[model samples]
Target: MTAKEIFDSTIKEIEPLYGNDEARSIAFSLLEHIGIMKTAVLAHQPMETDTSILQKWIERLKKYEPLQYILGETSFYKRTFRVNSSVLIPRPETEELMEWIIRDFGSVEEDFSEKPAVTIMDIGTGSACIAVTLAKEIAESEVFAMDISEEALKIAKENALRNNANISFLKQDILHDFIFQTPLDIVVSNPPYVTENEKSAMQANVLNYEPHLALFVPNEKPQLFYQRIATFAKKYLKPTGVCYLELNANLAHQTAELFDKEGFTEIIIKKDLSGNNRMLRAAL
Candidate 1:
């Protein structure tokens, strides 16, 4: 069959669940995964490929499974990272959080050899996207990533190795008390901020396919992770260090207040491309 035929058929099968625009996007991505480019598909090029694998993907999509999980990978900050049911898929908003940190610390002209190594820790580091990206993008950065799930940490380690980013992996539950041997220059996290009440508003693709432990908190304590992060920042972050977090837009102000109560004098809430208050920067 032709690439266009496969693309159109896949879209038709899943359009009801994802809508036309999203279905088209997903179809294009699936085709690209099989070495079929969008241009070739659109140009009506005939392609020879395995049909059974494509059929399996279509079946998963019909069940509201995420395409990233089906493909076993996704692109984050221009780098590919492996993902599965064990980890939450990295979102674009998280990229903005990485950018904010990079903008503050990254320099192309400066000699990193003359400066001390920038110490960074990523809490609840699912696929290690944030940790690995920071280690690769910033020169002379020593990175550490922690996650509660053993499976998630395994995937995170593979991503770190694949990207050739040096990171120390820790299996930790941030809700519990923990200690670090050295002071940190930066602490960053995109921890579980979505409350149980918000689950109804999310799409099936996310709710069904992604790891719930990394995506939600009790509705009564929506700021649970934020509170712990603020407390950890107070204890571990250096006097000149900063903390970066990806916020739940609906509770941005409330989350910021946690940092303020922790005596973080400087707090900045930055909006994502959608103009939602989605990123926070706090400093001691």
Candidate 2:
């Protein structure tokens, strides 16, 4: 079949699962991934292409599998990072968190040579998207990323190398006490904030395909990671160091309160593009 036929058929098959706009978007992405241009498909041009791979991707899409996991990589903070079921796909809100850090610490015109070294750690560095982006965008940043899952760390390491972002990867659970060789200028995370109860509200693509260990906390203690992060920041963060976190919209205030109780004086919650309370900045 031609590119147009493949694209239209893929969209038709998945439209019920993803809705009109997203289905079209996914279909276009699948075609582009296989070397068919959107322009050709749109113009009804009959571009010859492989059908077997396309059919397989379409089958997965019908099952509501995330396209990023299917493609094995995604664009985050304008850079491509490899992703798999081992790690959660990087979200736009995380990019906003990165932007906030870059705005505060990065200069568009300066490179590492002119800036003093800063130490930053990502507590749950699933895919290392946050760590790699900071290491690339912020000059002279010594970045460390920690994840409990060795499989996730393997993918994260590959991403760091792929982007040429020098980062140290550690396989450690943040819930347990860990040692940092030096004080940190920033502690950042987009950790597991979703409670088990929230699973029903999430799309099947995310609920079924994304890594649950990276996405969820027990319903009884929804604030588990944030609590640990607060304690970790108190112990390891420098007096002037800051913490940036991507928060669950429903638990934003409670998460900030955890930092507040930890004596983070300058606690501020920031919203994402949709204006949900999605990010928090805290400092001593």
Candidate 3:
């Protein structure tokens, strides 16, 4: 088949499940990634592909597997992130959170003679996207990331290396062993906030393919991650430290209130590009 033929087939196969526009975008993205042009999709060109790999991708798409998983990577903050079942796929909203951090404390650099170096910790760091991005963008900041999953940490570490972002990764479960002796200049996270009751409304591509451990919490205790992170911030964050978190859009108020009750000052609930209250910032 020609590039057009494969592209058409890919979109046609995925459209009913994902949507016409989104399916077309995915099809085009895959083709572009493999350097397959619509005109050259056919085996007429030496570069054209008619491999079984195409069929396998179609089969995976039918199963509601994310295109990122199929491609084994996704773009976040204009950087490529390796993703799989072990780690939550990086999202655009998370990129906005990273951008906010970069904007507020680019380099977090001090004169060194007058003040101490900046220190940052990312709790529940999944693929290390936040940790790596901060390390790469804030050269003078010391970055540390903690995640519960060993498998996830493997991918996170590799992502840090691939991006050449020097970050320290620790296999510590935030729920139980959360501890930091050093005063933190900043603490940030995009923790599990999707409750079990909300799962029914989510798409299968997310519900089936994404790691639930990193995406969800029990229905009865929806704000557990926020509460825990808030407590952690209260303990470790310096009086001048800032805390940035990606909150569940629907529960933005509750998440921000957690910080408020924790005595964090200047608590701010910020909306994403989509106008959803998706980010929260506060200071100790």
Cα lDDT tens digits for candidate 1, 191-237: 89898988999998888878999999998899999999988888998
Which of the numbered candidates is closest to the native, going by highest lDDT? Answer: 1
The residue pairs found clashing in candidate 2 are none
- lDDT, candidate 2, 42-89, per-residue tens: 778876677789889889887888899999999999999999999999
Candidate 1 lowest-lDDT run of ten? 106-115
Q: What is the clash count for each candidate, in the order shown?
A: 0, 0, 6
For model 2, the superposed segments whose C-alpha errors exceed 4 Å read 111-114
TM-score list, all predictions: 0.95, 0.95, 0.91
Residue 188, model 1: Cα distance from true site in angstroms: 0.4
- Pull out the clashing pairs in model 3: 1-42, 2-41, 2-42, 3-41, 3-42, 4-38
Question: Looking at model 1, how many pairs of residues clash?
Answer: 0
Write down the worst ten-residue block by lDDT for model 2: 107-116
> Which pairs clash in the backbone of model 1?
none
